[model samples]
Target: MDAKLAQIREDREELEHLLSLAQRARVKDMLSINLRKLDTEYIVTKEKLDQAQVAVTLGQASVTNTPVGRQLDANPVIKAYDTTIKTYSWDQSDKFVKVFLTGLGDLSQVSPDQIVQQFTQHSVSIRINQVGDRNLLFNIHHTGQPIDPKQSYVKVKSDMISIYLAKIERGRQWPHLRASDEVTQKPIAPPKIDETADPSAGLMSMMKQMYEEGDDEMKQTIAKAWSEGQSKNSPF
Candidate 1:
């Protein structure tokens, strides 16, 4: 049962990472649907594992007097927050913006008092106490828009923490999650093409530019496609 739960959880995490890296709208939709299915399966499997453990514990009550059983009871497994959450996702509605911070480990055993939140008119910070070896910290120095800090709040869940920011202006929409995104960086000009250059040269130049400017996942996808094309065209 433990092995089954672990496998399901691993699958769910992988699907989530792929969904984050997915580029196309169609692909994102497909991954999102499949990820949701895996999430449900993980929850069901976890419940079953818990039930099995409880049954075993009940059956072993008589053996608790033994040294081995006593030691086992004294030393429980501690799952720590070893994985740092580096990125977050946000969405907005008519009067609030919701920021989701995932990858938090096993908050079911953690108390609400252990989680601390600080909010200002335009920023928010979160700290989780006693995450085994280290404390977890998450902060947004500046929000895209002003929020009513008095009304904003955080919620801790078994898997993640969510921050709800109340929009000061009732129905106004936010342009971005962070204030930094609102300042547009200067665009890089496209590569210059000569009229006499080979038609394929122009395509190659465009691909090079994309590879230079794209994110890590985009660069990887382009490299994979280029390798497959070269392999298909090569002849011994």
Candidate 2:
């Protein structure tokens, strides 16, 4: 992803260089291309960063040792947190839009209202501006701050219903749009098995099926390997 992002930046820079020539077409290209790249992340990144921060918090609170918990001793600042959140967001948007488009049951379920709520209710700052003609048509701004997860304001209460509808409509028409870079990352699920739970479920499931269905010779081979192993726990 970093490579991809760098390549895009390089391409964008080339376009910007052309703009120095004062060519109308190159200037238009520079504006159009750069806006698309900007638009892709402007709104969604902050939302995703906030969501990821909550996840890290939840993981920290969990009884089990997790990546975040293990790294807590590192005393990471917000800067260290950002790249992970960005990666999380990129993967999420890719998977979500891919799957969503594959089986688009109803755009209504996409919930633009909920998205709007993120902004209006929680003081998230998302701005949108339409820029350019046919060559460079796209939203100019969609950047925002993270909403306070604890807030309960209703600034977009009346507007949300229609706003949500607009989101769905836009989503259907332009799955890869550089429009409202909305965060579609599912919050990490609560742990099903924690610090004290049966840690062998993962290895047990695999080994159990292998043994029960194995021929005698294969079972003997597995037993030989097992005798040298038999781990104290499973990591799943």
Candidate 3:
């Protein structure tokens, strides 16, 4: 999939270059013929890239549908935990709620023991497992209760868990954070246009340029190419 995506990107770059050349050429007819071909290739490659992206996303989702993940999802306490922490917007992949703790500052300075202590104070039971230097994987269970052998644990990132703890410290109730508080929509800016640049010479001008630049033989070839490209039955 990665290789295919790379190839598509490379193809797009090449197509863009060809399109630029076509737009600049003085012979309109010849340039138009090749421009259509380039456009078709660009569109097809773009569609393939989009399909590949969707397939990759679906593949990731399928991994989370395994037997263990299903069992964890079905657990009553885990469901409640999910409902309670939905405001944090942690990544719920696999049976564990994987949180990327790298967003928080200084993992080295943050003591895992201190974090576990804080959660205990808040009546949340969790087992902290540090993965490498940055990520802290949490296995959440009912406070002070031993994890059942049959029950799968819920996971959370240390950073989000810290935020949850902060809310508790402020005397906020369980599920205290509202959905609106967790999400804010940013307005998207319109694409910038360079006003000083030549207003695109347009397709007709490009075709004229192609015709003007080409020799007699080139002009004949371009005319044929254009006719073949424009044919309704042609499979270009």
Report the backbone clash tally of model 2. Answer: 1
Candidate 2: stretches off by over 4 Å? 1-23, 40-48, 63-103, 110-112, 115-236
Score each candidate by Cα lDDT: 0.64, 0.32, 0.36
On a 0 to 1 TM-score scale, where does candidate 2 land against the true structure?
A: 0.23
Candidate 3 lDDT over 1-236, as tens digits, reads: 34543543443333233333332122322333343343444445555765666666555555796876566446422100111122234333223222333343334444545333224321233333332322232322111121122233232344434422222122223331222122234422222323233223233344455556666754565466556546846675
Best by lDDT: 1
How well is each residue in 1-236 modelled by candidate 2, as lDDT tens digits? 34434543444343233223222322233234433443354334444655677677756656557676667645633332211111111111211211111121222333233332333211122221111111111122222212223332222222121111122122234333222233344422211223232324422443455456545653554465555344523443
* Segments of candidate 1 deviating more than 4 angstroms: 1-84, 186-236
Against the hidden reference, what TM-scores do the models get?
0.44, 0.23, 0.22
N/CA/C clash count, model 1: 0
Q: Which ten residues in a row have the lowest lDDT in candidate 3?
A: 76-85
